[model samples]
Every structure is written in structure tokens, then in C-alpha cells.
Target: MNIDECESSPCQNDGTCLDKMNAYQCLCHKGVEGAMCEINRNECLSSPCKNNATCIDGYDHFSCVCLPGWEGELCDVNIDECFSHPCQNDATCVDGIDSHRCVCQPGVSGINCQQD
Candidate 1:
């Protein structure tokens, strides 16, 4: 097949089978984690953390858990600096917890609707 076809092959989310070199490589996705990328890494499978902790995905590894008002694959979900609360005086909302921003009204300020 072609490279595009190989890249889009249904070799599983974590495993990748390349036909060029007559071989395959495992490029694990965010959640799934393993040496060969064969094993489905269940972030919530093990009770590693205490309390109703949440598992967060990481670059190479994962975090233990997250604190209150926090979320993410690796508890990296920080407080949205531009949440709704940041808006003022009928201002519109702007950036959210993640990397999202909102449109502002005519008399709004800041990256989003901060002031008017």
C-alpha cells in the first residue's frame, strides 16, 4: 500500500504497522501506554492514587492524580485564566480552561470579553 494508507491503517490506536520497511512500530496514543504499545494503558485501571483521584495523561508518563477544581490526563488542567469570571461589566467570555478563546462584544476588553 501507500504511506498514507499505512499511516491510516487500522493497526490499533497504539500500534502502527508500516509496510515500507516491511515492519510496524507502536506509536502509543495519549492514553494507551506500554513498552511495545500493545497493552492498553488504562489510566483508571489501577487504584494508585488516594480518594477519588483522577488520572491525567502526560507526555511520556502519567500523573498520579489531580486536586480539586482541576482536571486533565495528567492533572495538568490548570484554572482557565480567561474563564467566564474574568469577564466584567457585561463583558463576553474569552479563553477557556483549555486553549480556546471566545469572541467579545463591541465594548469588551482583554483577549475576550473582559470589560465594556
Candidate 2:
């Protein structure tokens, strides 16, 4: 009835309360939705990421930051670091997390097997 009801800030979490005819309406912030703005919306409820990536909730949405050895919008693609053939001296190139490993042959050594 009176605006004083909303003045007391019945809404929680910094919600804005609008006084109505004998009642009040709470305008909740992002990620919060309810009659009294007490419910927290799960941003990751729909599993927005692919390839088992982690989802971090944002203000009104979410972010899918891909992990190592993975890339793309949903982390569905595996990065091939050995595409350029970084290994030398007949070494084997193995793809790794944001990198590559050169498995040296019988007589080769060093990172890319460049040294004998």
C-alpha cells in the first residue's frame, strides 16, 4: 500500500523493488530471477560447451574457455601442433598441449632432435 514498504528494501541482493497497489514487484539483477529475487539462475544448466570443456558463468551468459590441446568455439577440435613437422633428424613428432614433442631416434637427442 504505502511506498514505505519498499523503502525498507524487502528485496535482497540489491534488487529494485517497485511498489504496487498493496504489493511490490522485485526487479532482479542478472543471473537472479524470482518473485523476491532469491533464486539464482544456473548459467551452465544447458551445457553450452562441447568436448567436456568447463563453463564459467558470466553476468547474463557464460564463457567456454577451451583447455589445453583443444580449440574452437566449443573446444570440439583437437589442435595438431605437429602439422608443421617440427621434428628433425628423422624424429617422431607427437602433438601435445599447445606444443609438440620430438621423440628422438636411436642416435638423436635434444628438443626437436636437431642435435646428434
Candidate 3:
């Protein structure tokens, strides 16, 4: 007697099974792999981020979120907040993490040396 492979629904993880000649084919889901769709693909396995950026894995995809003082698609670019010289009155501009600190001159105060 020819036993039907698809009768018992041997496919797992919501995979679809196609019966062939004395064999079967398992069509796995988006994030699933392997013969019976038993293995879940690891989205973070390739280390998609650069420059020490954090990688968040998702369904069949991943995201690279830059850390402080960094920006870009891969977080490989350094953000320079003081490039525009935000400090006024000759105040020193000290670049910080995702921000800048204005070292005001003598008798000067406030973030951009706007106040005494």
C-alpha cells in the first residue's frame, strides 16, 4: 500500500508539504529553515552593524541603531556637534556624546555663553 506522506501533515512550524514520488518537500516560512522547517534563522548571525553599533534582529531582517556620538546607516560615522561652532563669545566648544558643551570664557556662563 502507498502511504500518503501529507496525510499526517509531517511539516512543522507552519511549513507546507508537497508530496513527491516516494518523498516530500517542505516549504518553510519566512524565518524558518531546515528540512521540516524546524530551524529558525538567526538574523543577527552576520553582525550586520559596524563600528560597534547595536544590531536588533527581526523577522528575516535586522536593524542597526547607532550609539551615542555616532550616526549613519551602519553607525560608522562620528557625529560632530561642535562643527557649527555653537559656542558664542569665543567660548570653547567641546564635543560630547550626541551633544556639545560650551566652555564659556571668564565671567561668561550658560550653554552657549549667552548669559553672564
Q: By TM-score, how accurate is candidate 2?
A: 0.61
Q: Which lDDT tens digits does candidate 2 get at residues 1-116?
A: 25556877889777899988778899999888888888778788899888779998765678788888788877888899999999999999989777899999998899999998
TM-score of 3: 0.61
What is the lDDT, from 0 to 100, of the residue 98 in candidate 3? 84
lDDT of 1 by residue, 50-113 (tens): 4456655444455666666456554555656565365555654555444545466676666545
TM-scores, in order shown?
0.28, 0.61, 0.61
Q: Where does candidate 2 clash, by residue pair?
A: none
User: What local lDDT score does residue 113 receive in model 3, on the 0 to 100 scale?
Assistant: 96
Cα miss at 67, model 2 (Å)?
4.3
Give candidate 3's error at residue 55 in angstroms.
1.9
| Total residue pair clashes for candidate 1 | 4
Q: Please report the candidate that would top lDDT against the real structure.
A: 3
User: What ranges in model 2 sit over 4 Å off?
Assistant: 1-3, 58-61, 65-67, 83-85, 89-116
Error of 1 at 87 (Å): 36
| Ranking according to lDDT, highest score first | 3, 2, 1
| Model 1 poorest 10 in a row by lDDT | 1-10
